[model samples]
Target chain A: MLETVATGHQAKVSAERGAERSLLSQVPLLSELPVQDLTRIEQQCRYRRFTADELIVDRDSPSTDLLFLVRGQVRIVNYSMSGREITYEELTSGAFLGEISAIDGAPRSTGVMAIEDSLVLALPRSVFLDLCTRYPNLALKVMQRLAAMVRAAQDRILDLSTLAAQSRVQAELLRQAQAHRNRPNAAIIEPIPVHSDIASRVSTTRETVARVLNDLARKGILERCKGALVIHDMRRLQSMVSDVRG
Target chain B: MLETVATGHQAKVSAERGAERSLLSQVPLLSELPVQDLTRIEQQCRYRRFTADELIVDRDSPSTDLLFLVRGQVRIVNYSMSGREITYEELTSGAFLGEISAIDGAPRSTGVMAIEDSLVLALPRSVFLDLCTRYPNLALKVMQRLAAMVRAAQDRILDLSTLAAQSRVQAELLRQAQAHRNRPNAAIIEPIPVHSDIASRVSTTRETVARVLNDLARKGILERCKGALVIHDMRRLQSMVSDVRG
Candidate 1:
């Protein structure tokens, strides 16, 4: 919905602006901007809220404003004609969406749905483009972000081209394992990553994931703990993935 | 090679700059720049030439200069650990590459090889970023170009997720046929499109492509007219692709 909710009170507006200023500071794209510039941007930003599972943006829609995730989570997804939902990526608080269409004046390529109650700040396309031009550093940052995105897509393409469905699942596990490693003190965090989510990520059916996990469990490699799979032989799992992935 | 070749004759430089001005005008990212600005950019641009089968850019290379294809053809490719080459995309004249790293300061995601004897104009990242900041339209164009890349990747991802090998091959054919239709009077262009190229594009084995083509010919859907397959059943072919691709 494009409709904006009016600000509550002047005092509350002041408090929210302060909180927003801090939140905007954490956003990779806007973090480089000065506090004054951030405040300026905050003033022009329009706010909206979406409920859980609400469709925020539809694929091929004409909406072009960049949505900054102020709170909650959203998933970028597109459904095939057969009604198969392909989840592309998920963004939590601080990540932004719709910049592609916002800059290019094109329709949205993928739809976005709020995973939970999400609050977003909609910055007009003109204002964002103006800010990018006004700051070369910001423009460079934007380019870097886009570059990262291209690399990610290239990685996915490589996986699809080089590996089969089973190898892809292992590679997906390795990727999550690496992400887990990167997080400080995440080692004891058991039962992580939903199997269905893993299936979607590897572009395979949940049945395949269940079979893989069960096979691994029989071999004393990994086991399912409650809602998630736990990797026991991490090195063996890595080798199994790299052996086929390579 | 980062080394620049010394200019031969003053008259030659003067003549080439004029041609370069017009050529720069055709580049979508730089087209919006004024004649004078294009000239200025042309002055800073360095020229390089590569022989057929020469590696122009290597995957994960630290070099980061945007290369504008002035003449001939090039292909972006990456190899699996087993040494199987997967061709990503091919570009001819008036196209460019290396912008992802040039903007982001990241390593190249894929390697570029010269398909034939080709010439390129290399623009330094700093100068390109400066021009982008100076001209919002140029930056907007840059974003649009990047957006186009993202959309292309997303489309590929969708195909990978929803379609199997056979469907992908058919989809690729449909894509090529559409591209053929878009070209003015390309109907008489029989014996076009090498089969090996088709295999590379769909990320499948050449044997699979051969089998699919043979099946289509047996069914009188498409026939191999010497070097290329002439698609006789266009509507049926499209419908077959959509039925699966959807």
Candidate 2:
């Protein structure tokens, strides 16, 4: 009976390891890593769960463990001194977080809140650094990701400094459409972006987002379908964005 | 004699090498590299010069050589499709540029314009990547720099999205004062910031910047001295910023 119990326990542990390995395979940085290498790092990590609307990482926290989002979604956000919340970006499954603080040992730039029930694989800072040092490609991938963030941020800053409110709304739609690529010269924002979510992205109010959508719909640029917003006049819409971006 | 000519040539070459070494020493990323390592990289780089107001790196250029600013200043800028100019940031001597493109092999995010007669040391993208791969500390520094940029940009985005025009001005002054820390509870903005520069930073008009300064002076929050702007009440100024940030 004791021998059978030992075998059953081994099977359970092996099943958990198999599940962990599958999640690790989803991370773009670790995707190219060999199976054994992925197994080695995942073994050094622990799994954690957070429920919807729960804080995953505190902004002022000093801990800096790199986290891999294996399932569900989370958003990077911060509250103004006045307690107004600002959402920076959202991450879905297969994405990762905490690399900035992990690399520099600084407090997080913003807090992370789970938008849905999330399962994360957390790797200690030391182990993550060692992994980067061992894999040049991993380091390059991280650098590229950081560079893209900088580029996106700069574009936003420029837009905020120059574009009018209407143009800003148009520019934001084009941005969203580009992110959700479609056929040649045509695009659709799938999952139907909420007015408040688009408001945050464009640094405006939900009312303004609704107004802009109405204007676009009337102009035959875009229209809301059952579950998506279809952008039809890609050329005209792009011209509107460039009108102020110019 | 041929031997005498060779000796003179060697002296001239050593003098150039000495100057290059001193400049490389100033780069924060390369400062920790050994003298021989610095010399090796410098030997592989070529020096380039630009006149004041000249374009150093075109925004659409395909080249991605990492550049070290050995002398003078350059501003990262972009023109809107309609010809409106946006100044992103400025880099002075000892600072570096082009790492974003070098890491991602992407197009330049913005053009670099020489603000004064300048000298730059250009290293091939491959050499820079090789150096980063070989030096873990160097990679860490680059990552840290990129992270800092993201943090700063996010702060700007939040301010633009929420703060009133006057509050943005107050917040900007607080930001600049913190950057140029002086005695506790007081700070001096030396060389007195130009209204246009502050305008760009706060995403307001030059008139707005001037009006805000005048209002602050009337309230005894800050005063204009002969060559600088002095903040006499840092706490009050900070409180005003937090009023909106809050």
Candidate 3:
């Protein structure tokens, strides 16, 4: 009976390790890490589960760990003195948060809250720094990821500064289409969350999102089927984004 | 005379080395490298000089080198099919440009041009990777810098998405004040660049910039004295930005 219990414990540990590896595999920054390195990294990670609306990272708090989203979604938000809370971005699986603060050795600038029930793997800064020092490839990958995020932010700035409202909505739809296109059997239809989530991405209100989406539907460019946003004419939407940019 | 010439040659070489050290000093990314490593890294640097309006980077071209704005200024611009050119940012001394492509080994997404006679120190991919590998602290600094740039981009996005035209201008002024504060300033009266440059940073037209500046002057928030812009009331300008955000 003692031997059997020991075996069961080992099996459970193995399963947990497997889950950690799977999560690491999904993160683009960690995708290139060797299996041994990943296992070591997994060992350094602290796993925590969060319920909906739970604050994962608080503004002004010292950031000691890098949080990687394993399942569900997280929202990055900024609250102003006027009591306006702006949702900057929605982060899903395969995304990491708090890296900037961890790297800078600074306090968190914004709050990160779970949008739904979620699991996160938090890697301590000491371990991350050690890995970065030992593995140059990992450092390069992190830099690349950060640079890409910067580019995405630049694109957002361009949209907000120059693109028209209709065009902004269309550009977002195209982004959704491309994201969903990567999955298996992606051609049939894509699942988008709520209009509110979409609104947060584009920095518009949900009412504006609904109005523009309805306009697109009326124009025969898109359709709502089975509670999913379906693109009937991708070319038209592309043109709209281009027009707004121009 | 021969001795003088020999001494001058040695001086010139010493000066070159000194300039390299200064450049290395300003860039936290290269600070932790040893002398020999820095010499090797400097060897990989391609020094290029550009006259006013010369294109350092063309949009859509594969980005091959990271340009360090060692001296003078450069402008980042995005051109559209409708022949509209929007100036995104101006990079001055000690600022880095063209890092997006260099970091990702990807194509240049925006055009960069010398707005003034400029000297740029460029590092290729191999040298960048080498530095990252040899010095982990340098890698951390690079990541931190990239993160800061990303944060700046996010701020720009927020301003564009949420703020109106007038507020965008005011926010930009506040940013300028902050940047000036970071620099070694001799006095409160700083020579403001051309209105066009300010317009670019704020995502407005030159005429609009002029109009706004004139209005602010009338409001006693700022004053133009001997071709210099003096902020008479920082509180008022900040309040203007806050009002716009609201």
> How many residue pairs clash in each candidate at the backbone level?
0, 6, 0
Compute DockQ for each candidate against the true complex: 0.57, 0.55, 0.44
lDDT of 1: 0.77
Interface RMSD of 2: 1.8
i-RMS for every candidate (Å) is: 1.7, 1.8, 2.5
Number of colliding residue pairs in model 1: 0
Leading candidate by lDDT: 2
Q: Write the per-residue lDDT of candidate 3 for residues B134-217, one digit (tens) a residue.
A: 777877778888878767776676666667677777777776775565333312446786787777776777787888888988
Candidate 1 regions with alpha-carbon error over 4 angstroms: A1-26, A34-40, A182-191, A218-230, B1-26, B34-43, B182-191, B218-220, B226-229
* Tens-place lDDT digits, model 2, residues B185-232: 889999899888777656677899999999999999899999999988
For model 1, residues B89-154, the per-residue Cα lDDT tens digits are 899988889889888877888999999988778889888777777887777677777888888888
What ranking of all candidate models by DockQ puts the best one first? 1, 2, 3
Candidate 2 stretches greater than 4 Å from native: A1-22, A81-84, A179-185, B1-22, B81-85
Per-model CA lDDT versus the true structure: 0.77, 0.81, 0.72
Clashing pairs in 3: none
* CAPRI tier for the interface of model 3: acceptable
Q: On a 0 to 100 scale, what is the lDDT of residue B87 in model 3?
A: 72
